[model samples]
Target: MTLDELRATAAARHDTCAQIKKMIVSRLDLPIEPAWITDDQPLFGRGLELDSLDVLELYVAIEAEFGVALYDSDMSVFGSVSRLADHVNPALAERAPTGSA
Candidate 1:
């Protein structure tokens, strides 16, 4: 692809990541800004300190906000904001960065 197309793809992924971060923060009622969460930051346990309850909330919120249902998916889907972005926005899945999943 051309440089412009590559940049546009990156921009789309970045935007999706940002939206996931905001959804996590808002849906989970976390005491932090959405921008504070990095695209690669972990979403559970040691990373964002989320738990099973948080994941349930996210499943519902994701469906409502992004029109993607992740309830039947595995826990790996919550590996990070970038990973979740791939699921919520399948267009990004093809161009997802290595190890983002």
Candidate 2:
């Protein structure tokens, strides 16, 4: 791809990550602002300090907000903001109305 196309892709990815951060903060009633959450920061443990109950809440919120069902048994997607964004954005794209993309 051309440099312009690459930049566009990166911009879109950044926008999606920002949107995901906002969604997480809003849905979880986080004390921190969305902009404060870096994309690579761990979602649980030492990073955001989230717990199992928070994970459950996140699952529900993600399903309701993004129309993506998250299984609690699968923790791979919860590793970081970027991971969640990677998982959710495609689901969002798929749920978009036909011909929207």
Candidate 3:
């Protein structure tokens, strides 16, 4: 699985940006992205309104959903939604489509 495969999977299951935002919000238990979480915005710092705790939650969420173990130092890699998509893509590629998420 590569980043391309991961993006393909996420896009396929998530479909619209709104749906993708909902999936992230629900999975990570964040009151975020009521609209669409822009692919271009940072999901960290004061950028997309995320804090370190959110990153911790995201670590858990990513581990659970994609079966990828994200290191504490690796949090920097997930700064943006695009990065998260990149980080999680290969792992997702290994999983067979569960059908419509």
Candidate 4:
């Protein structure tokens, strides 16, 4: 998987950053600016609005969708959508190319 692959996968699920932002805003009942949830802004506390529980849910969702096992450290990588994007881009890149790798 590559960045483009991940982007394509994310887009297919309507689960990309922009889509997730809308979901979070509606789900959390948050007062947010769509512009504020950039690819890099922290997604909890000072930036977005998720807490520990939300993190867990997001992790579950990500794993379920991507078939990836994210460790604790990887969880920290998701501090912001952009940060998560950083981790995910590389992870997908290193996925052994399915049967080829």
Against the unseen true structure, what C-alpha lDDT does each candidate score?
0.89, 0.79, 0.62, 0.59
Rank ordering of all candidates by lDDT, starting from the highest: 1, 2, 3, 4
TM-score of each: 0.91, 0.81, 0.59, 0.53
Q: What is the C-alpha RMSD of each candidate to the true structure, in Å?
A: 2.0, 6.9, 8.7, 7.5
lDDT of 2 by residue, 37-101 (tens): 99789999999888989898888888887788877446768877877876777743343332321
Candidate 4: tens digits of C-alpha lDDT, residues 1-101: 89998778656433455655664565556687664567667787887667888777766655665455565664456666645654445543254232321
Candidate 3 is scored at a TM of 0.59
Model 2, which residues run further than 4 Å from truth? 91-101
Candidate 4 backbone collisions, by pair: 39-82
Candidate 1 per-residue lDDT, tens place, 2-98, comes to 9999898889999999999988888888899999999989888889989998888898999999999988998888888898899999999987654
* Clash list (residue pairs), candidate 2: none
Worst 10 residues of 3 by lDDT: 92-101
In what order do the candidates fall by TM-score, top score first?
A: 1, 2, 3, 4
Q: Which candidate is the best by lDDT?
A: 1
Each candidate's clash count: 0, 0, 1, 1
lDDT of 3 by residue, 1-101 (tens): 79998788776534433443565789667665545577656777766777777777767767777676776555556556655655566453345332341
